[model samples]
Target: MELNHMTEKSLIRYDVKETTKEKVIWTLVESLYEQGYITSKDEYFETVLAREKVSATGMEAGLAIPHGKSSAVKKAGFAVARLSNPIDDWESIDPNNKVELVFLLAIPEGEAGSTHLNLLAELSTRLMDKEYYSRLMAAENSEQFIAALDQVSVKEKEDKDTYEKTILAVTACAAGIAHTYMAAEALEQAGKEKGIRVLTEKQGANGLEDEHTATMIQEADAVIFATDISPKGKERFQGLPYIQVRVAEPLGKGDELIDRVLNNPDGIVSAENDTESARGSENQPANKKTGVLAEMGQAILTGISYMIPVIVAAGLMMGIAKLGAVPFGLVNEINDISYATHDNELFVILHHLDKFGFMIFQFMYPIFAAFTAYALADRVGIVSGFIGGLFAAGIHYRFWGIEEGIPSGFFGALILGLSAGYIARFLNQKIKLNKNFQAMKPMLIIPAISVLSIFLLNFYIVDPVFGGLNVLLRNTIEASQESGEIVLSTIIAAATAFDLGGPINKAAGAIAIGLAADEIFPLTARVLAIVIPPIGLGLATVLDKYVVGRRVFDANLRVTGNTSILLGFIAISEGAIPFMLRNPIITIPINIIGAILGAVTAVLLGAVQWLPLPAFWGWPLVENIWAYLIGLLVGTLFIALANIFIRHMLIKRGRMTITS
Candidate 1:
C-alpha cells in the first residue's frame, strides 16, 4: 500500500481533548477499530503498549509515533491525533518536550515486514520535514490535516555522479531509531545543497536500510561515520579515510561535516587509527570525557543485556527439567541427581538438562567481564577481562596460613571487568611504543601486563577481602536460618526487592544461588523474595482499579502490570521496573515491604527450595508449597492495599489529580 492510502480523513482527529498519553492512544485505537482497520481493539492496544515498554516512540518536535503490528489489525492504517495539551513525561528523545502530535499505526501481523515498514519509512521521512510538521500542527480540522500530509513530497533517491566528490556515511545510535534516520536525512539534504553525491546507510531499529555496497564505498572519496555505537562491518571501510563523530553531530551539522571532508582531506581520520582516540578526541567539546564514560557505561550495559538471555533461557530450562523429574523422585533433595550415569531414562534426561543449564550459568561471569572490557579497550581487553573474571570466580589464595577460594560472583566480575578495561586503556594511552612495535602493544604488551596485574591484584588483595566477606555473609544467613530469625530474612527480602534487579537485588540473588549450589536449601527465603515484588506490584495495579473506584493505573500500565505478574511467575523480577519507574516513591517501599513479609512468612512456615530457580512452576519442588502460596497471597494483598492507600493519600493532598 502507498503512504497516501495508509492515511485518511476518517483517521485524522484534530484538537483531541485527551489529557493523558494512554487516553490519547486509546482514543485513536478506538477510531481505528470503529473504522474496521483493526479486528480487535484490546489486542491491538496491548501490542502497542508492549512496544512502548521496550522503548518510547516519542521523537523530537513534539511528535510521537506509537505503532504496533498485530494479528488484531485487519489491514495497514494510520490514525493521527493532535492533542489539545501535550502529555508530560511521555518518554520523548528530549524528556523536557512533551508530545502533542501522535500518529498511531495499526498493521496486520502478516503485513509488518512489507507494507508496514514501507509506510513507517515514508511517514518518518515526512515527519522529519519542518514544513510538513508545521503544516500538520497548524491544521484546524481533519480535512486540513489530510491536505497538509498530502502536500509532503516523497523523497526520491539522488543519482550518483562519478565526476563529483562522492561520500558514503553510516549513521547509528544506541536505540537506532530516531537519531539514526535523522542523521541520514540531514547528511543527504546537506549533500544535495553542496553539489556532492552522498549515500547514507541508516542502522536503525528495523536493522540496516539503504546499505552502501562495496562498490559505493570504494568509489567514495571519504566516509563519515556518525554513531554512538561502534559501526557494524567497520572493516569494509578499512583502507578509506573517515571522520567519526557522535550520531547527533550529523543531525545538526551535516553540511559542515561534508565541507570538512571536501575542503580539508587531511581532516579525515583513517579507519586504521585508534578508534577510542577518534571517538574521545581532545579537540572535541568539553563533554568528550563524559561521552567516554557514557560509552564505558553502555559497554557494561551491553554485557548485561547479552547475559540476560542466557540467564532466562537456562533458568527456565532448569525449572522445566526439575518439573519433569518430580515423578522420578530425582531432584527431591539438594544435589540428588548425580553427574554420573543414571539408570532411569527420565531422570537421566532431566539431569543432563539441569547440567546444561548450570554449564551456561558458568559462562555468565566470563562473558560479563569480557564484554565490559571489550567496551572499554575494544578487542585488546577481552583476554585480560576474561582472565580477571576467572580469577574473581575461582582464584584460591593463602594469607597468614589461611586458605580460601574467592567466590566474588557478579559483583566481583563487574569490578574485575572495569579494572581490566581501564588497565588496558591506561597501557594503550600512557605507554609510548615505537611505530614499528605498535602491533605488539595490543598483541603482547597490553594483554600480558593487564592479565598479570589483574591476577596478582585479585589473588593478593581483592580476593581475600571479598572472599572473607562472602564467607561471613553466607555464615550469617545460615545462622539466621538455623535460629529461625525472620528479621534477617525480612532484611534480605527487602534488599532483593528494593531496586528490583539492580545491584542490591542481584547481590542477594547471587548469594542465594551460590548457597543453593552448595546444597544449602534453607535459603529459599531469597528465592521466594525474588518473585514477590513483581507479583505484588502487578496485584496492586489490578486491585487499585477495583478498590479505588477510579482508574489510578493507566490502560497501558495496567497491561504492563499483568505482564509483570506473568514474568513474576517465571521468577523474573525486572518486570516490575516499569512500574517502579512510574511511581518509585510509593511503588518501591510497597514492593520492599511485600517481599519482606512474604519471605519472613515463608521462612516461618519452613518453606525450602532445593533448586535455584524461583517460579510458581517450581512450587511443587519446594517444601511446604501451601505455606509458600499463603505467604505469596498475603504479601500480594498487603502490597495492593498499600498502593491503594498511597494513591488515596496523594489524591487527598492534591498531589495527584485523577480524572476518573
Candidate 2:
C-alpha cells in the first residue's frame, strides 16, 4: 500500500469542537467507523485507550497520534482532526505543550506490525517538518488538508556537490516510540536545508526501519548517535567518527549538530574514544569536582529502574497466589511454606505459581548487576556483571576453599557488578586485537576473561571482605534492634521515606529484604515505610479540601492523589514521587516523620511481616492485622495534618496560592 493511501480526504476534519480527550477520540473513531475503516467503534476505542495507558502518543510538537490495531478495524487508515481548542494533559514531553492536531489511526490486527508501522512512521517523520506542520495547521478545508499531507515526503532538497559530505544518523530512545522518529525527521530536514545528504536509521518501538547499510556507513562523512540507551550493534560504528548526544537533542538542535559536523570535522570523536571517555568519567573519584558521584548515582538508578518491575510483578503474583491458597488452608501465613507438602491440585497450582514468582525474584540481583554494568561499560559489562551478581547471591565454590555460600544480597551485587563492569571496560581498552579477531573479543574473549576474573575476585577477595562487612552491617542493625527496636524501626522508616524510590530509600528497602530473607520477620519495617508515604499524601489531599475549608489542591493533584492512594494500598511508594518532587521541603519532612511514627508504632504493637512484600492486600499475612491498620491510620493522619499546616502557613505568608 502507498504510505499516504490512508490519508484520504473523507478522513479529514477541520476546526473540531471536541474539548476533552474522550470526546476527541470518539469523534475521530466515529469518522473512521462511518467510512467503514472500522467494524466496531467501541472495540477500536477501547484499544486506543489501552495504547494510551502504555505511553502517551503525544509528540513534542502540538500533535497527538492516538492509534490502535485491533480485529475491530476492517482496514488500515487514519482520521485527522484539527481541534478548535487544545487539549491539556495530553502527555506531551513538554508539560506546557498541548495537542492541537490529532491523527487517530485504525489498523487491522494483521496489518499492525507491517503497513500500520510504515504509515505511522511516515506521519511521525513528516510532522517534524516545520513547513509541513504549519501547512497542516493553516489548511482551511479537507482538500487543503489532503494536499498538505500529500506534500509530506522524506526526501530533502538535493545538492549533488555536497553528496560526498553525506551524514548517516541513528536515533533511539528508551521507549523508542516518538523521540526516535522525531530525531530522525529533524536530522533529515536539517541536512536538506544545510545542503548535506542525510540517511537516518530509526531504532524504534516498531523495530529498526530504514536501516543504513554497511556501504552507506562507509560512504558517510560523519555519523550521529542520538540515543539515551546504548544503541544496538554499536560495534558497527566503532571505527567511524561520530557525535553522540541524547535522543531529545535533535528535536530543537538538529541543524546545529549537522553544522558542527560539517564545519569542524576534526572535532568528531571516534566511537571507541567516546566509549572510553564515558568510562573514564564514570571511574572518576567521588571527591572529584566533576560529578562522578552523579554518574554512579545514575548507574544505581538504572539498576533500580530494572529491579522495580521484577519486584512489583513478583510481589503481586505472590500476593494473589497467597489469596488463592488462603481458602485452601495450604498457606495459612507468610512464613516459608513448601509447595511439596501440598497435594490438592488447586493449592498445588497456586503454590507453584508463588514459587515461580520467587524464582523470578532470583534473577533480580543478576539483572540489577547486568544492567548496572551495562550502564557503565555497555554490552560487555552485561555478561560479566550478571555472572558477578550470581556469585554475590550465594553461589558457592568449594574448590576455592569456599565451603559455605555468602549471602551478599543487593549491596554485594552493586559492588561486584561495578567491579565487573570496570574490569571488562579496562580489558576492552588494554587488549587490542586485529579486525578479524575483534568480533571474538566481545563475544568470546571479554566474557570468558571478565567472568573468570570477577568470579575469582568475588570469591577470593570481595567475598571475604565485603561479605564480612555485610554480616557486620546486618549484625549492627540486629544489635540496635535488640537494644531499641522502635528506634531502629523509626530510623529505617525515615530513610525509606526520605527519597521515595531514590538511593536512600532503596538502601533501607535492601536492608529490610535482606533481613527478611535471613528469616527476621519483625524487622521488616521497610514494608510499612513503603506504604505510608503515598497513603499519607493521598490523605492530605482529601483533608486539604475538607478540613482546610477550600480546595487547596489543583484538579491534576486531586486525580494524582486518588491514584496514589490506590497504588499506596498496594505498596507502590514510587506513586508519591511526583508530589514529593513538587514540594520537597514540605512533603519530604512530613513523609519521613509520618513513616517513622508508623514504623515505630507497628513495631511497638508487635506487627510482623514474614514476606518481603508490602501491600494492603497482604494484610491477612500480617501477624497482627489490627496493628498494621492502626499504624497506617496514624501515619496518614499525621502526614495529612502536617501537610495542611505547611500549606496554610505558606498561603498566609503569601508564598502559595489556593487553586479554587
Candidate 3:
C-alpha cells in the first residue's frame, strides 16, 4: 500500500462564506465531500462533531482545526477556510473578532495514528508565530496565502533532514494551561532557528503529560527548563546540561532560548549566568542544600502510595462491619461495635472484624503523611514528626472530648512530620560541629535536635493548637446548628465543588475527615458529600454530551470523572477535575450548589453517625446513613435534571448538533 502526502499548495482556500459556526462547519464538510476528499460528508462530519464534543480543537489565535479520523476518509487532506467572520464554537478563546481561520482536517482510519499527530504538531508550530499568522490573515488572494504556507511547509521539511543536535527543554505553568504549550513551541522554534534539535516535556495538574525516552533526553547537549509549577520529572533529567527559565519569559523572548541553552554549563547545579554570581565566592558556602526537597517529595509520595490501599480496604470493610453492629432495640448508643448488638453471633463476629479493620484504617493517613514528610527530610523527620503525630492522636483520643475515638488523627501526623522535617533542616543548617564530627550530624545531632524539638512542640505548641482546633470544631458545629445544618453542609460542599479536588476541595475534605474522626459527622454524611461530587459531575457530563462536546466526553472526561469516584474512596479529591475543567461554566456552580445542599441540609436535619471511616471511603458508614443517601440522591437528581435543561437549550440554539 502507498499514501499521498498533502502539500502546502493543496491546503490553501480563500473564499469561505458561512458566517455562523455550525453552518461554517457543515459548509466545509460539504465542500470536502464535493471535492472528493472524503467518503461521506455526513459520516466524516459526524465523526468530527463527536470528537469535538469531547473538547475543542481551537488551539488559540484566530484558528480552529475541527477534525476526526475514520475509515471514511478517501485520502489524507486538509481544507483551509478563512472564515468571513469569527463564529462562536464554545471555544476557550475570545469569541469577538477572533478565530477567523478554520482548518478542517481528515485522514483515513489506517493513517490516523502517528501521522495525524505529526500533522497536528506541524500545524501547531506554524500557528506559534503571531506575525506570520497575521500576515496569512491579511493575504488578499489564495495565491498569496499559498505562497506563505509553502514557505512554512518547505522550511519545516528541509530542517527535518539536516543534522540536528538534541537539546532538552521543560515547560510548566502555575495553572498548567495557556503558557505551558506556548513556551514549549516557542523554545522549539528558537532551537530550529539555531539548527538545534529539541525534546520538551510538560508537568501540570494532569501530572506529566509527555514522557520522553531516557535515551533521547540523555543524548541532549543542553537543557532548558521554563516553569512556575513544580517539575516532577527531575530525577530523569539529572546530570544533564540545563538552564532554567520562567514559562512567560520564554514566550516573551523566545529567540534567546537557544542561546541560553548553548551557553549553560555542561553539568551543574546552578546556571552559569546566575544573578547571584557574587555568592559563588572562593570560600563557597558549606552545607549546601541540594536534592533535600526532591528526596522529601519522593518519601511523601511513597508513604501516600502505601497508605492509599490500606485506607480503601480498611474503610470499606469497616463500613460494612458497622452495618452488622447496629443495635435494633437500644435507645442509647454504644461506642463499641460489638456492644451495639449482643443477640446475633454473626453481627458480633463482623463487629469484631470491624474493630480490627478500624485500627488498620486509623494508621493509614498518619503513617503515610509522616512517611511523606520523612521522604522529604530523611530519617530525622520520619522519626520525630511521626512521633509528634502519635502524641497529637493520643491527646485527641484522651482529652479533646472525642466520643468516637480519634482513630487516625491525620492532622496530628501531618503537623508532626512537617515539624520534624523543618526542625532537622534548621538544626543541620545552624549547628556547627568540629570538622571531624560533621559526619555524625545527619545521623546523630540532627535527629537528636529534631526529636527534642518535636516532643516539646507536641506537648506545648501542638497540644495548644489541638485544643484550639477542637474548640473551633465544636463552635462551628454549634453555630451551624443554630443557623440550620444546611449552612455547614453548604460551606463544605461549596469548597469540595469549587476547584474539583484542588486546594479548596481538599480543605473541605480535610474538614470532613476530621469530623468523621471525632464522630461529629456520621460516617455516611461524609461519604455522601465526598462521593456525590464526582458521581454528580460525571452524570451531568453524560447527560449534556452534545454541549460538553463529543471528543472530550469520549476520550478524557469519562475516565477522569468515573475514576475520580474511585480515588475519592481513598480520600483523594482531584478526581472530578476533567469535567470541571471541560465544562466549568455549567459544572462548577451546579456542583457547588449540589454539594452545599447535601451537606447543610443533612447537618440541619441532625444527620449524625459514629463510623470508623471517612465519607471519602465511600458508602457504608455515612453519618446518619439515611441523610447521606438522601443528600447524594437529591444532588445527583439536581445535577442531572439541570444538565438536561442546559443540553436542550444548547441543542435548540445549534450549539450542540445531531447532524454532520
By TM-score, the best candidate is: 1
lDDT of 1 by residue, 1-660 (tens): 246677778888885899877789999999998889987676567667755654457767788877765656777778999888888778765566688899987755434236555665566666768887898889888877777776876566567743388888988755444456767887888888888888898875566788889898878888888876677776577556667677767655788989865654333332223433333344342223455655555566656555545555555666667667656555533235563466766666777787786666556567768878877776778898987766644533333344534456555677788889888877876676666776788889898999998888777777677656555655655556454457667766876777655545655666667656877545567777788887877787677745754445544456556766766886767556546644666888888888888877877887776676576657887888888888887777888788877876675454543210
- By summed lDDT, the worst window of 10 consecutive residues in model 2 runs over 281-290
Q: What does the lDDT come to for candidate 2?
A: 0.70
After aligning candidate 1 to the native by TM-score, how far in Å is the CA of 105 from where it should be? 8.0
lDDT (C-alpha, whole model) for all candidates: 0.69, 0.70, 0.56
Question: Could you give candidate 2's per-residue lDDT for residues 219-253 as a string of tens digits?
Answer: 77888877765566666765555667667667767
| lDDT of predicted model 3 | 0.56
lDDT, candidate 1, at 402: 40
lDDT of 3 by residue, 1-660 (tens): 111144344445566777766676787787777777776665567667665654445555667766666445676667778877666554632333256788776745433235543444455456677776776777877667765653553344535446467777777654343355667877777777777777778653234656667887667777777775445555466556555555555654666767755664323332111112222332221112235654444444455454545655554565455544444422112236545476867656666666766576455545655665555554446666566656644644556675533222444555576667667656654666665775587677777777788778766776566556555544554456335345656655665566543334444556666765776654434445566676665665465544333322323344444555554444444445434433467767877777667665565555664553444333454446676667667876676657556645665454643221
User: Which 10 residues in a row give candidate 3 its minimum summed lDDT?
Assistant: 270-279
Better of 2 and 3 by TM-score: 2
lDDT of 1: 0.69
Model 3 scores a TM of 0.46
